[model samples]
Every structure is written in structure tokens, then in C-alpha cells.
Target: MNSPSLVATASITSPHRVGCQAGVQIGQACWELYCLEHGIYPDGVPYNDYGDGNLDPFFSETKEGRYVPRTLFVDLEPSVVDEVRHGVYRDLFRPDDLVTHTEDAANNFARGRYSVGQEVVRKVLNRIRKQAEACSGLQGFMFFHSFGGGTGSGFMSLLLEKVMEEFTSPSMLRFAVFPSPRMSTAVVEPYNAVLHASTTMEYDHCVFVFDNEATYNLCINKLHRAIAAIRVKKTVQFVEWCPTGFKLGINSGPPTVVPGGDLAKTNRAVCMLANTTAFREAWARVNLKFDLMYSKRAFVHWYAGEGLEEAELSEARENMAQLERDYEEVDGHDDDLMDNHEF
Candidate 1:
């Protein structure tokens, strides 16, 4: 038998109630889906005795034959995690895997990265290390977060930096929810998103950008089927040195929408795994917004008060600008070289 390729997932959210709910709900949905796929119940018990599916990628068997998810739910505040503790799928997760703090990030990226977030980072890292040690052959990490929130952007960036430094070999994939201007909850979202993007750009190997406005439009305007196509040969562009692109997969059935969720019920669904230069568009737009505020130095004091240096902000802006140019250069290149080579 081949060694199990264990992939640990971390669901981190901002201190905002909405962000927290989104993250926790997504985590719960994924756990439920995994259990359903593997013939396991919500309490971690198998449905029947004869099922032989490979559950090692996201689960670990306990002494009582119960399967626990190799997933972690983290927040800067305890209310969200407390819900998980009392939730229906509570039994599926270990108590130590749910990490939280008494203080919140207060919608400030600097606070999340430098102040309040630092207090719980060590404990969270210890738990993550224990999870890593339990795995036989660890493959990589999958991070679920939002770019618009404080903890999601700043705290997640810090965690990604540390994880990249320690793991080194495993590929890191991010499922990042980008903020929409029309639906934005916080004014500092642009700043948080840009800074987070610049900080974690080099750390993440692959990122699937999810836009709230775009998804809403797709669901409202074109409601028949969920078909999102990105042509790698023409529309998509990848970095020359890195293995980056998009992989399209169409599931046979519709997505399982959680109760009281915002998603619309559909007949079909499509998922796009991407690490393309096209993501630079998001960076560019957010950077433009960042410039609007940074030009006036609006609300810069909040971050500065939380130990963020003026030079770091400037550096983050420049880094994202440079990244956009890098993507443009990659996009201008011919696909001939990539066609002949293999990643």
C-alpha cells in the first residue's frame, strides 16, 4: 500500500462576526461532506462495517475507531469557536484543535499581526505541530480565509509565513475569498487585502480567488449551470519559474448548501484550482483602492499605533506593484517554452 498523503487544513477567520461565521460554516460543511463521502457519521463512527474508503488524507483513526478530522479552526475571539464547540459536528473535531483568544483584532491588520494575534500564535503553532507529527507522510496545507478581514488577512499571513518556514517542502494552497467593493463591510479592507496579498504572495504556491460580487452575479444572472471556464492556452498565464495554472473539474451533482447559507441551490457546480497570473488583477484593483486611502494617510495611525512601521506599509505597496508587473511580464511571454517543458 502507498503511504497516506495527509493534507492538513486550517480554517482561519477575522474577528468580525460575519467572517467568523463564514469560516466556521465552511469548515463544518467540508467536514460533513468528507464524512458523507467516507461513510462516516457526524460523530465519527462509520456507517457500516464493510466500507473501505481511504480516509487518511483528512482523518485520523482514534483508539475507539472514531475518525477525527485533521483540521483546525482558528479565530482571534472565542464566540465563533464556542459555537463550533456546541455545534452539531462538535464531536468530529478535537477540543484542542479549536483555537481562540479573549481579545479581538478590532478590524485592524496591524493588531492582528503584531499585537493580539501574537498572544495565541504559539499555542496554535504547537497544536499544528502536534498534528503534523501525527501524520505518516504529510503532503501539504490548505488554508481557507478571507482577504478582507483583520485576522483573516493579518493573522493568516503570519501563520502562512511560519508554516512556510517550517514545512519548506510541502506545497501550500489557499482558498482566499476576495472582498467586493459593493459588499465590503470595512473601509480598511483594501489595506488589509493588499498588505496580506503582498506578504503571503511568495509563501502560497497556489491560490483560488473567490470574488463575492462575481459569484453573486453569476448566480443571479446565469442561474442554469455553474460553468466557469479559464483557458490556459489563451486566457490564463502562469509564472515562468513556478508550476502555476488552472485545473478545471466539474462535479456531477450540485453543491451541498448548508442550512441558512447564502449560496443558491443549483443543479451543477464547477471548481477551478488556479495559480495563474490572472490573480494579479485582484491585486491591482485592491492596490488602486489602497493608494486612494494611503495618499491621504487616512486611518494610518491605527496600524501605526499597533506597531506597524511606515516603511513596512510602503514596502508592502511596492511589493504588490512589483508583483503586478511581474505578472504582466509573464503574460507577455509566449506559451511555446512552457509547452515543451514539464512542471
Candidate 2:
């Protein structure tokens, strides 16, 4: 039997674009407002507390009720540290919370100009592992990363890898808003990051992808665009879909082609259960369905072949069972009751 190469796994690592953080916050805030109006508590708080003027910022809980907005600085440029650390971006993060790629590390990668951004990513993964463990007891970590630009795409993938490596015991779920090639970035980095991330699906799962192009088409003017993009009328449901042992990362293109026909338009929602019997049941209950039809590859036609070895596929299936069981047990806990009812 042939081994399950990265190509085969890559097919399953499909990603959806969820527009920018502003859009996500708008969506969440709308949901929170709706819930508040109906006399129910909001689930996850939107990252932007001040307003939509700033890009989406990362927020962490202090184990106490306080929210600590942290800015993690990771990039191939040392100047980015200065930009984020002391410049206009300084207002975003807490003091002493910024993390960056070493000057030597970033310089080497920049000089070589590798497409992967592996070295800088390695540093980011290590730092995040430590930070995530320390903050694990808190209300989980939230990242407001953009799918556009080089640093956000590169660093987001790397940080995700490290979190998976360190946290095996029911790790905190990740929520990402992928940028549309037409809107988030006209550059090539997002296209590259999408392909790379897709190829490495064994590393992460349940990404909320969105496209800027779609949003742009929907909005008529800047004011309408701002309002429409940031204000989706729905409750921000924080669904924690654990990795379930089988990791799924997304990699696609700087110019990936969207699949043709209805498939081309549909936003594929994938629910991965760690190849186990228990997880199968959980997956059945979860019923993750793709509500929107968005193209997986937006423009670039980079195609990675698919096929997994029988043994690897079997193991993934087995893991799914345990994950399903774990999901029911943990997810079953009533967050609504706990939030409203005091001890």
C-alpha cells in the first residue's frame, strides 16, 4: 500500500475565507447585541472593545474576569517589531506581551527569502507553546490575524503548528478570518499561505475562512461596505471544534483557482473527527455543514494530488472515535447554565 503523503492529506485541509477581523467583530457584536436584547449572555466577546478603527487585536483572559489585549509580533523584518512595538500599533498590546522572531533568525530568512518562512515560524511556535500553557486555565486565547500580508499569513500558520505540538489535552480551539484575494490582499503572500496551509492540514482544523472579494461585491459604498462588512446580523456562536488527534492545515495559492460549477461557489465546511468510533458519533451530533458556497482556490491553479495510505486512514478513523466521546463529554457541559447560574 502506498503511504499517505502530504498531497493526499492536503486535499482534506480545505480553508474558507471569513473576511477581515473587522467583519468578524461586527458579526460577533451583532450576535452579542441580539442575545443581550433577548436577555441572554453573550458567548465569546468580540476582540475590538474600543471600536472598528483598529485592526482585530488578540485578547486573552487573566484567569480573573479581566481581558488582556496582547499583541504578538512575529515577522522577517526587525523594523516590524519597532512598528508594532513603539509606533502607532503600540496602543494595541499589553506591555511586555509582544513576541518576535530573533533579529538573526529573521535576517537570515529575509536574505535567503524562503517562501515557507520556516525559521521565524519555528521561533513563534516555541513562544506560543509556553504562553498557551500558562494561559490555558484562562478563557482561552484569541488571535486577530489577517490572511492578507506576508507576516500575518506566515506567522499565523507557524503559531498554529506550535499550539498543536504543545497542547494535547483538549487544546483551545482557533478562529481565523481568511482574507479574500480580491480584497484582503492583491499581493501574492495570501495566495501562497493558503496553499501552504492547505498542504499541511494535519496541523490544525476548523478555520473560519472568508473572502474580501465576496464582501466587496456585496457592498455598494465605503460606508455601506464598512457597515455591511462589520455587521452580520447573527449571534457569534463560538464553536470549539477540537483537533480530535488528526491535524488539518490549509495550503492553496497566491493564485489558486476556485473549483467550477456549484462547488466553485460553495464554502466547504469540513468537520474532522480524529478517525475514531467515539468521534464518529460526536461528528454526527455536531453536523458541520457548509452553509455558503465559496471557492477553495480563489484564482491560482496550483493543484496538489490526493490519496492517503490505508493504514494512516485507519488510524485517523480510530482517533475520531475517542475525539467524539471527548467532545460529547466536554461540549455537553452547559455554558449557558454556568454563565447565568452562580455557585
* CA-lDDT, candidates in order: 0.74, 0.35
**RMSD of each candidate relative to the true structure:** 5.9, 18.0
Residue 243 deviation, candidate 2, in Å? Answer: 26
Q: Give the TM-score of candidate 2.
A: 0.38
Candidate 1 vs. true structure, TM-score: 0.82
Error of 2 at 58 (Å): 8.4
lDDT string, candidate 2, 288-321, tens digits:
2110111233222211111112233224333544
Q: Which candidate has the top score in lDDT?
A: 1
Segments in model 2 whose C-alpha atoms lie over 4 Å from true places: 1-71, 87-96, 102-116, 136-139, 169-181, 184-193, 221-343
Candidate 1 Cα misplacement greater than 4 A, ranges:
1-21, 218-269, 274-278, 333-343
lDDT of 1 by residue, 1-343 (tens): 2333333333334323345544655666677777776778778988877367688878899999999998888888888778889988889899999888888777778988999888988888888889988989877777777787778888888888777777757777677778777777788988888788878877878776778776677577645532233332243444556544434566765666655757787777665444455556667678988999999999899999998997888999998888888876866744464344222
